[model samples]
Target: MASTPIIATLLKGMAMGAADVVPGVSGGTIAFITGIYERLLAALKSFTPAALLVLKREGWRPFWAYVDATFLCALFGGILLSIATLAHGIEFALAEYPLQVWGFFSGLILASTIYIGRQLHWRALVVLVAFCVGALAAIWLGSVKPVNIPINTLTIFAAGAIAICAMILPGISGSFLLLIMGVYPVIIAAVTEFNLKLLLTFMGGCVVGLLLFSHLLHWFLQRYRQPTLAFLCGVLAGSLSIVWPWKHAVVTVVDRHGETVPLVQRNLMPWDYESITGVSSAWPGVLTLFVVAVVMVFALEYGARRLQLKRAANAA
Candidate 1:
């Protein structure tokens, strides 16, 4: 099999990183959209006792090839680069242009949900039930109020483990999970300040959690492709709760930086937004951005298909 171009994988990883910076977006969703989801899962799931044995017996080169280390390096390198560069920019956009930014993400997620749902055998009762169950689970999870967990060694470690699991799941947001655990600020601060001790501890948890969760996801996807995809589709559909274009914060919390940040927000209609907030709803601009985002997803898929066909033709 032809290895995916390094540049292409790097670009996809950057896109994933950008999505992950936001509280509502999932890098896994981007990976799925970009056609590397299975490869990523396989690579991550390869880090096992068997791979260690292969390394001990064969060598570093064989183990590296077996685990696809080059691909992982390129992809993760891009993710890290993007997060380092774009974290502040994304934060500014979210704060300054909440409506338009969220509107765009809402469209992306909605289109992704449709795209994934179409691949499932919707006629199957099990698939339908799984979709509904997944949707409800997402909604319930999103609606839960954030908790104020005291920042400690154990909590930070646990937060990393839990959040990294969500990070790799389509429609789940690891940053939001951190928010729920009241550690989002800490993680962000650690990243910004380059706190090596905390960063290392967090990454340790991420590695452990990722390995464990990737195995489970790979197993489920291998055995029950249709139902598993249906569930993911439903989760994507339900994730609209977080990305809704119009919302007002109902609960706020003060961060360690002493800045008041929103903890809970209620979705609102455009007209209701104007009436309540006494500011222009700016619905037209938001709606236009949303439509563009929807079109962009479809366009990306079309281009990907064309690329695959071109590659096949060249190989032939």
Candidate 2:
């Protein structure tokens, strides 16, 4: 409720916004590492029909209390601000330095897998199988080519629903989901161009999907922590296929903006990337950035742990 706490929440939301923009990274991962994941789920779960009834019966203040509106507003305000400000910068980086950008994301995800996997009370056989299944599904999904669908209200709405669901799930990237659905570019364009009508439609779908999926995920996590974590670890492991630094596009398509982009790509070694793309590959730079990403995740985890300890000590 204090300005200081609100500012901290806003910063966390900004971090989540930055992660969500990248293809292989999930905002949910940020939420987890920042120590807000469970609280966020609990807040989302508060948005029940009973809450709405309370809103009608007791007015704005009671409704806000029922839903933790202050926290949600601050968090989402930060997310939207980050997205609006960072969209072009992220897009430019991805275009101008694809290898480095992806390398960083790859490192972040790899670290995330380790971080989340550690939280599981591992049943060796079950965890392994869950990890494998998640990885295989992500790999298969990565290999699937994007389809060219006619952009209409319904299509945009559906894309938002699906993408938002993925976005909130740890190890699953919502932007990657959009890319797979062939709507990433459209959505990016909408954001950059300030296309309010298209943005609103997509947001409506996102709201619906997020509300429903958050509740389901909350239940799943509460009831099946180990299995859920295992599956998420697997998802992160499998998603590596999508963020490999060196890749050659196996299939390409022209988007609505008449720009050529990769539809399907085959992973390549650094030397092979140089040979194929005729670009310097810059292996040193890529590796350095990748390491930086990994270190950053660990630093975040350490900070969050310290904060938790401090809170506990103060309460005691």
In terms of TM-score, the best-performing candidate is: 1
How do the residues 1-316 of candidate 1 rate in per-residue lDDT, one tens digit apiece?
2598899999999998999888888898888888888999999999999999999999999999889898999998888888888888887898888888888888888888988987999999999998998899888888888877887777788888898898888898898888878788788778778888898888888888999999999999999999999999889988998778888888888876788877778989999998988988888889999999899889988888899999989989
Report residue 133 deviation for candidate 1 (angstroms).
Answer: 0.9
Model 2 misplaced regions, further than 4 Å: 1-4
The local distance difference test score of each candidate is 0.88, 0.86
Model 1 stretches with alpha carbons more than 4 Å out: none
User: Candidate 2 residues 1-316, lDDT tens each?
Assistant: 2122889999999988988888778898888777788778878889998998998999999898778788888888888898899999999999899889988888888898899888876767777787788888888878877887789999999988898888888778899888877788888889999999999999999988989899999998899777777888888889888889999988888887888988778999999988988988889989999999999989999987887788779879
> What C-alpha lDDT, on a 0 to 100 scale, does residue 213 get in candidate 2?
91
Poorest 10 consecutive residues by lDDT, candidate 1: 255-264
Against the hidden true structure, what lDDT does model 2 obtain? 0.86
Model 1 clashing-pair count: 0
